[model samples]
Target: MGLLDNMKARIGPAKEKVSHLAQRHGGTIGHGLERAAKLVDEKTKGKYSDKIQAGTGKAKEAMDRLAHRSGRSPEKGEAPQAGETPRSASPPSSPEGPPPVS
Candidate 1:
């Protein structure tokens, strides 16, 4: 096998295991990320507040994607209430008018 293939084979199982664990504890992981970000922002005396917020948001988004890949995503607005069929993950259709003129 090629070098890249060999490396992927070795890493694939570990990645799958990590993904499984992430799916199971995604909420906790997300909370931990938020907590850390808050602590860092406080330590910096609010100097990097905006950057920290953006970083935290990106981290949460990545976690959600990982959880979703393992079929454990619990995203709000993506869940169906009792007696309702689960909706696809597709974005809702936009109500904005047609594309603007060139």
Candidate 2:
């Protein structure tokens, strides 16, 4: 197999393992990510706070994808609870046309 294919083959199992762990302990992982980011920010005295925040957001997004929701919707950066259906991206309907003057 090509190098890329070979690498993927080797990494497949590891990826599955990580995804499972993320699914099971997503919340804990998220909390750890947040705490780590906070500590790093404090140590840097907010010098790279923006970069840190961006990186942290990306990490949480990755964790969410790894968690693999089924039925209920999980909050951002969190795993779905047991027996919960995956939450749909349902938006509230716009009632009527325009809002009355308040």
Candidate 3:
């Protein structure tokens, strides 16, 4: 087998273990994330409130994905809630390509 395949095989069990743990403690993990974010926001006096909030949201979504939570993800053939966008959706691509960097 190729080196990458061998590595994947070795990591498979660990990934499964982590997934199981995340599923079991997902709620606690989410609470901890919220608490940490709140403390950081307080410490920063809300200077970076928007960035912090965005990061926290992304992190929580990632955790939900790892735990295989159904509520956070739209199942096949299911429609997302009003005002909610699925993670799989991306912004419209610009035919002009990326904007120039300053």
Candidate 4:
């Protein structure tokens, strides 16, 4: 087998173990991430608030995907949660189409 395939085979069990752990303790892990982000934001006096929030959100999303909770996955077709914009959503298009040439 190829090197990458061999590596994946070896890593498969570890990935499963991590997924189980994430599924079991996802809530606690997410809470910890939020707490740490809040602390860091306070320390920085909100200078990096936006970036910190974005990082925390992405981390939580990753954890959720790892846990595979609620059948949410790219392969399964994810539905956005309330108040969330879907990641693949495009910006609204102009009804008028392209701007008129000068």
Query: Candidate 2 at 52: error in angstroms?
Result: 1.1
The TM-score leader among the candidates is 4
Q: How would you encode candidate 1's per-residue C-alpha lDDT over 1-102 as one tens digit per residue?
A: 999999978887776777788889988998899899999999999999999999898888776666556633345667653333554657788879998789
Task: Report the Cα lDDT for residue 17, model 1.
Answer: 78
TM-score of model number 4: 0.68
| TM-score of candidate 2 on Cα atoms, chains taken together | 0.59
Alpha-carbon lDDT of model 4 = 0.81
- Candidate 2: 10-residue stretch with minimal lDDT: 80-89
Ranking by TM-score: 4, 3, 1, 2
Higher TM-score: candidate 1 or 3?
Answer: 3
lDDT of 2: 0.79
- Provide the overall lDDT of each model, using Cα atoms, as 2-decimal numbers: 0.77, 0.79, 0.79, 0.81
The prediction achieving the highest lDDT against the true structure is: 4
- Tell me the TM-score of each prediction against the true structure: 0.65, 0.59, 0.67, 0.68
Worst 10 residues of 1 by lDDT: 80-89
Q: Which residue window of length 10 is worst by lDDT in model 3?
A: 68-77
Each prediction's RMSD over C-alphas, in Å, is: 9.2, 10.4, 7.7, 6.4
Error of 4 at 68 (Å): 0.9
Candidate 4 lDDT tens digits, 1-102: 999999978887778888889999999999999999999999999999999999999889878777874333243357755435677778997878788889
Candidate 1 stretches greater than 4 Å from native: 71-102
- Which residue ranges in model 2 land beyond 4 Å of their true spot? 69-102
